[model samples]
Target: MDKIGFIGLGIMGRPMAKNLIKAGYAVVVCDVNQQAVEELRACGAESAATPAETAEKAGTFIVTMLPNSPQVREVTAGENGLLKGIRAGQIVVDMSSISPIASRELDALLREKGAEMLDAPVSGGQEKAEQGTLAIMVGGSAAAFEKARPILEKMGATVTLVGESGAGQITKLVNQMIVGINISAVAEGMAFAKKAGVEPRRVFEAIRKGLAGSQCLEDKAPRMFEGRYDPGFRINLHIKDLWNVLETSRAVSCSVPLSGQVIEMMIALANEGHETKDHGSLGLYYEKLNNVALKEIQK
Candidate 1:
């Protein structure tokens, strides 16, 4: 089997690397967090001291599951970046949610060195990542996608090659836009139900089978009702995702009226200090606006 380099061992990255290991790949992993690297090393993955080391270990293909574009740049550029040691015919597949423009720029840079790049951001959150059931949106050359398909298949249930360079990030931005708007809508709906003396849970039960239902409503409404705001996906991350959408929309001269409004509301919520909370905590914003708490309604 071919060796693979995996970088970023956060919530999603850890499990993703694990699945690759379980699939019997020769996986070499790296992260800024030594502890995260140690944990993966314990799971039969070889440890690389740096991103460049990981790239050198797996010359043909490397996978990055980083946080944002800046982190992506840091890991792929400069003396310490993966590109420093990467050779031609090698491929770097970024599963990080980043701007399409940034991905395109990186692709150009990597191509100059005889390597290829794929913008292949994923959806389905940590739970799906842990279960190896993410939906991966890929954008790159057809041959590059084919080379990376088997490895990507181990981590995602749905892996699609959307189009050429940067299209995956574009698709992921679309995914985040809908997710941001949908979760906020779910939050407001739950809040309205509580304020109207209806049990938020029962309200979800009623709409869950109707046209008003959505994956966001089912996944987030219960957490909103229970006031469980643990960070499965942090609000700050979603805020960044929304900012990407807004910025990309502006660059393309696209008018996303509803998405723009949701981005403003998310910024307001984050500014009010909900950035560390789970995005489900957005329900609390509506609660504050209405001066009615779900806990009070439950009583």
Candidate 2:
């Protein structure tokens, strides 16, 4: 088993790293949150003070599950960086949902240093992360993908290598697009039903078994009716993803009117202080506009 160095021990990263350990790998972890570091250590993982330190000790391969492209770049571009400790044959696999263009750039950088890199982003929110059943989309050379397959399997139920560098991030963007659009439609439908004097719950049940049924509906519909805004995935992060969608669309000369509209609504929710709430809380916008609550929000 390869010694694994995992950086970023947040909601998703901690669970993923734990599963690697559970698979009988020697896993070392590092994070800015000392509490998170200690928690993983308590599970039999070693802790490191910095990315460089973790890379040095666990140089077989490193997995970064950070929040964004900027943080991923920051972790690899300096003295206290992953690349500093990466040897000629080491692999770098980033599981962050970030820009594909940036992923490609990082791939080139790692290759120049005689190492390999994979842009392997995941779907299935926090719940699935804890369950170790995420669907991972990988983009890298065939050899790199093959090398990372066993490691990826420990953290994800389905892992597919789609194409060359950046494909995984592009796939993740498509996922966010579909997810954002579905949540928005669900919110609007619930709001319209409530204001039209039909019970929102009943309306959900009726359509959910029809052509409108989806994983989004099954998972987020109840949360909508209950007005639960906890962060399974935050609205703020969705908004950031929409920004990426718009940028990617512009580059491809594709017009996505619906995604554009949803982004504005998400921005509206963010402006109203629901940015940190679950993306399902998108219903809050419609509730506010219609002067009705989908369900009584628990205080």
Candidate 3:
């Protein structure tokens, strides 16, 4: 296995990088969080101070799981950026959920430097990230996808090459749109169950195995029942993804009114300082509107 440079050590990135290390890859990590860097170092990973430094040290592959397009741009093209150190034949696999347009532009920039880029975003939230069972959707050259499959498989159970340049990020936008809308629907239904004086858990159990059941229902309904708003995936980050969805939709002449509504509800919750809370807090939005709490009502 080649030495891999992994950047961005936040909730998803940290565990994904650790899995690469566990798989016997010589990993070099870069992050602004010194504590996260030290923690990974303790796990036998090397550390780099900047994206450029990481690229220089890791040589063949550099992977970034950053927050958004701006962050990805800065790390790849700004001062001490990866473009400075990436060589011809080196590939940068960006696993961040960012704008598909931006992903294409960045790929072009890397090509100018004789390097290649792959837009490979992932799903399955923090739990699956820790378990190394994420579903990765990739968009890039077929050859590059083949070369990077083993490395991606270390962090994801399903790795697929979807299309070229920007398709992976576009597919992720579709994923987020469905997720955001489904979460809102779940929230509304559970709140309705509570207001109707039925135990939300009972309703969930009654409907979970029927055609109404879904992965979102399975993952988030329990969190709603328990009122656990811990960050499996932050409301703030989901908001970012939805907003990107809207922007991309506008560019391609598509309508997403449902996503727009969910974004509004999430923003309402964010204004109440629940931005950093789990996205399952969409349930809390219904709770507030209906003047009932899911946890308290269940009790």
Candidate 4:
């Protein structure tokens, strides 16, 4: 029963940490938000004053589910960061969506300090986080993956070791690219259905059982119909992921035409102030473009 340090208690982080605790892991928690720290404390977690302290208490296994690469750097390399306290043979598993190159650099830096790094970015949104059914894509040495697997199993349904040191981030970038493009296509399909005098829900029902169906359509189309754009996964986060994908693709000299277009559309939607909404709210952008109010469709 190894002790664990869990950092970053935002929408997905909080639930994932909770699952680890509920599975009987001794979790030491930290977050910049005092309220998030307090919530974890109430759930039987020990609160740490800083990432370094958390690392000191947990010793070898630390998990961070942060917002982005910069935040990841701040927690791991800042003055009071985790690296300041991490010792030899310790493992730092970063489950944040970040660049593979950044993960590779961090891996090298952490290794110099006698610690190992793993990029284990996740998918399936907040709902899956709460359910402990996330899809985790891991990239690290085989030994590090073995050390982290048991704990990761508590937080995800499908955990895969895609490759070594930054491969997980690459896989996650591919995941986001397909998700962004598919969700946009779903939005466009819904809009087409609405404009053509077909019942949007029926259109969803008809196509859902056909070749055009997808997990995105099944999970997000109903929410779009109900106008429930709650932030299971924020629109801005997808925009950030796309930005990472664009940069990663450029670095590899790869062309992702659909990914590029989807990124631009997400940027436009975010610029129009839908950043805080759910990614499914792209449907609203399509609705507006076609001059069809969501309420009108419900009638």
The candidate maximizing lDDT is: 3
Please give the lDDT score at residue 112 for candidate 2: 84
lDDT of 2 by residue, 1-299 (tens): 78999999998999999989988999989898999999999999998888878878885689999998888887876568877777788788999888887788888888888887799999987888888899999999899889889999988999999999989988999899999999988988888988899988888888898999998899888997887889888998898878878877897899999999989998999999999998998888888989978984466
Candidate 3 global lDDT? 0.93
lDDT by candidate, in order shown? 0.88, 0.88, 0.93, 0.90
What lDDT is obtained when candidate 4 is compared to the true structure? 0.90
Ranking by lDDT: 3, 4, 1, 2
- Model 2 residue runs over 4 Å out of place are 296-299
Pairs of residues at least 3 apart in sequence or in different chains that clash in candidate 3: none
TM-score of 2: 0.93
Error of 3 at 93 (Å): 0.5
For model 3, the superposed segments whose C-alpha errors exceed 4 Å read 196-199, 296-299
lDDT string for model 4 (1-299, tens) is: 78899999999899999999999898999999999999999999998999999999995799999989999999998989988998999999999999888899888989999898999999888889999999999999999998889999999999999999999999999888988899999989889888988878888888898888999999889998888988877889998998899888899999999988887777788889888898888888888889874433444
lDDT of 3 by residue, 1-299 (tens): 79999999998999999999999999999999999999999999999999999999996899999999999999999999999988998999999999998999999999998898999999988889999999999999999999999999999999999999999999999999998999998999999998999988899999999998999999999999888989878999999999889888999999889999999999999999999998999998998999987874343
The per-prediction CA RMSD against the true structure, in angstroms, equals 2.0, 2.2, 1.8, 1.8
Q: How would you order the candidates by TM-score, starting with the best? A: 3, 4, 2, 1
Cα lDDT tens digits for candidate 1, 119-223: 999988889998999999999999999999999999999999999999999999888888888988887877787778887787788889999899888888877
